[model samples]
Target: MTTKKQKSNSESHERKGVKRFESTTKGSSMIEFISKSETIFLTSLLFVIRLAAATWGIINDCDEVYNYWEPLHLFLHGEGFQTWEYSPIYAIRSYFYIYLHYVPAVIFTHMGLSKITVFTLVRVALGIFCLSGELYAYRAISKNINNTTARLFIFFTMFSSGVFQASSAFVPSSFCMAFVFYILGAYLNENWSFGIFCVAFSTLVGWPFSAILGLAIIIRMVFVKRHILAFIKISFLSGLCIGLTQLIVDSYHFGKPVIAPMNIVLYNVLSGPGPSLYGEEPISFYIKNLIVNWNVAIIASGIGFILSLWPSIGRKNQKGVTEYVSPIVWITATTGLWLLIFWKTTTQRRTIFIPNISIYCIFHCTYL
Candidate 1:
């Protein structure tokens, strides 16, 4: 009986020792995971600080464009859904953004909200959008690259001089940047439903041009070959839903099935400067404006463009050249197409935001 009792005591001690060892191992793993996560969080925080500094510098030197003025004015006057003759071009454009501003304006107007309140709210929202977009960009890049490299790319892209200028002067473009980031994140995961929802919400926030996000889906299908069919299907459905909803809203208010009148006028005024110089304006006019407005981005992008083609410069054996080659090709091709098809105007600074950001991502991911 004594021998048997001693044997049972020995077994119990061994079992306790094994359990303690396992617990220690798990504790170490949890600590390591937390440390890594904290590092990522710190990196993102630093990036935001850098971007905010750049943006603040630009805002201090520039005045806000009246982009939000028209919408605010209309809402203040109780015009509700009425169109402005000066910018009637909005009817054919994305109405969602205008409505976003309208909601606040309507509520405030009814409540007799002060001018200071309205302006403060708008500016605060803009700041949040900028920060959120940068965070999203960092997350997207980190998925494919190391955290340090992803943060560096996001920092450079967000704090670039051109981005700073656009964020300060171009209100709509700032919102568009946020939407683009959201779209990229959703696309990276092949989350078509989320992507489409983001695109729609972005379109409402003054990025009517978000209709162009469809191009990204097509590019993904042709190049990445990830969920191509689902992407196409969801994109079409979401677009239809957004369009029909807009039409119904407009028809109910303005007796029209399209956007507001002011938007139309604005488009016509800006759309005059097309890809080629053969139209009404001289080549120098567009060239001069492009250089002046996109000076910093253009210079950085030019360097990236050249670097992307040089295979022997930064060749990595692990991923091969395909990884480097694909992104470079995509950025260059899309940027060139954009310059060729769209009217290059300094006023539309937001046009270059996404492409520039993409270029920055490629540069850091491949070289840095």
Candidate 2:
């Protein structure tokens, strides 16, 4: 009878243990669901905010006129604004980039939308497109850093005027910025090919100078002893495809075979005077711009970088990765270098500096 009692007690304890195991598993799954649902909800809300920003009226540069909206207008209505910049002789501007938006406008127009409505819709579309790039970068940041730091990055990026200004603007820098997102995203996600392709495509089809973003990553990768050979191959193939496609489409428009990228390179770089010939500024131009645009964020980012190099200030991150300085820190540093060197502009310019502000915020929290 004692033996029977012992067996019965042991069976009850085993059943209780099984119940606890099930309860714990259920709780973990619920927590995961809540986390994922919150992320989706927040991302959706952010998307809506960007859409509103697109429809809002903001004065953009004339380049947005001649380079994008104008070309698109002519393509759609058979006549619109034109500027000397698009002259066949120079071929500095791109129809390839314009067509990306033009095709969308075409579809929306076919649905009986007015030109103004179509244009507005397209603007919103472009804004969403740009926002996705930033989101990709956010995901990449989260992967490298803790959830807390990543959340800080998002909060800062959401309110940044520079991001709002650049995201909806129908310009090359704005367009290239999306590719910049993918490049950074792919790099952080460990997709070397997608990252290299973004860099190549942005350089080929958007702004040539945008390739500078890619160069920073390559240096970082080499430093970390990653696959340099694969990056080179991916870059070459992507650049070649983009170049060949651009040549074919542009040749038809210009009425002669023209290498637009080279024309831009020679005109911008090899020319004796450079872009400074048109408009120039003192060193204080950018300093003023940064103060006006991203004052708090930059301070945070500055702190973050300091923390990364010297980690004694904070507890080790949850990942047990003590020295995991985000590759994106280099982006802010490199882009800062670019701005310092080229403070002078051919036109009145506002530095499109959204990413750094986001970076600085994350860095601020990370190190502190």
Candidate 3:
């Protein structure tokens, strides 16, 4: 029963295990091992930079005033302005995710903290949340790609204006970007529970429109595992839990029953004439916007896409090497789809934010 091939294969596996242990002792990556010290330094730098941004980044959007800060102010002081989006008539905005930030603000404020102090605390908290998402992104990318590539994209995310803004701004789009980070990471790692929770939370509480991003992961899981019913069950349960929490909190606040997610879908999509009531432009608008935000990343993504199509084009024979073309191909396709959908449709600046997030995700994923 001890065939020559079997003995050779057993010896090969033993050799690999020994080599891996040797590499571990030598402090060299047999594959990819990023140092804990470097990760800590980068994380600290990200927090400090985002905090600086919070202190300096002026509130630019009126929606940030009405939809987030105002609601938060009301939840604290019992009086704040409202907007059409938060109108009791429409209930397009949910207070559930908003409460996640401001309820703490209220507590701290009640505990003798100044508004300015509590605001800083809130910003720091948001930065930490955003950083958490990026940490997941980093882990996902590092586990699947070259360590150097993972570190480089970490730099990109740490320095990105969009990311800084997202961390500092009090909008659902910005907040959902935080969730987007974890969802992508969980998708790659096949952590179905976390992936479903994040997707559901983002869509149900942060922004219903964000389901667009979640759809990518859902499709992949459903198709790959050939378990459509399982995914549906998970999604339904997650959505029900998140949606019910939002309905309760928002209903109490609005003084009526409110299914905010459904209202959001009705207003933004199913309503007659559509959200074009705000503005619309040719698809070229988002292309121009992306060029402004991420020109270099876009160029690099094109290079990655080309490399993925003909993986052998740039690859060479390397004994004992593990190839990374398949993941790159999938990342290329996902990022391509992200860009096409966000850019080809009617758009706004907040809508454009997803592209920057996608670019970061693709850039890191392709680094494999």
- lDDT, candidate 2, 1-368, per-residue tens: 56988999999999999989978976765454347776797679778777877888584687777667888999998998777667897787777777778888999988999977897888789878877877777777666544565666677667767667767778777777667767766766767778788877888887787766676578666665366787678778988898989988888888888777777778878875656566666667667777667666556656656656544433444445443454545655565565654664523445444333333344444544
The candidate that achieves the highest TM-score relative to the unseen native structure: 3
lDDT of 2 at 181: 67
Query: What TM-score, over all chains together, does every model reach?
Result: 0.63, 0.82, 0.85
Compose the digit string of candidate 1's lDDT tens values, residues 1-368: 56988999999999999989978965764454346676577556644654454345444222133344554565567433333332333344434555766676567657877766665555545545566665665565565434565656665655565555444233555566656666666655556688677776556434555446435545655565566667677767876776677666655545555654235434545664422223344445556655665555556666666666766344552334334344335433454555554444333342434433444444444443
The models' CA-based lDDT, in order, is 0.53, 0.70, 0.73
- Pick by lDDT: 2 or 3, better one: 3
Number of the top candidate by lDDT? 3
Q: What is candidate 3's CA lDDT for residue 74?
A: 85
For every candidate in turn, the CA RMSD to the true structure comes to 9.4, 6.2, 4.6
Evaluate model 3: give its lDDT. Answer: 0.73
> Which residue pairs clash in candidate 2?
301-360, 304-363
lDDT of 3 by residue, 80-181 (tens): 888877778877888787789876787889899887888877877877888888888777767655566667777778777778777777778777888888
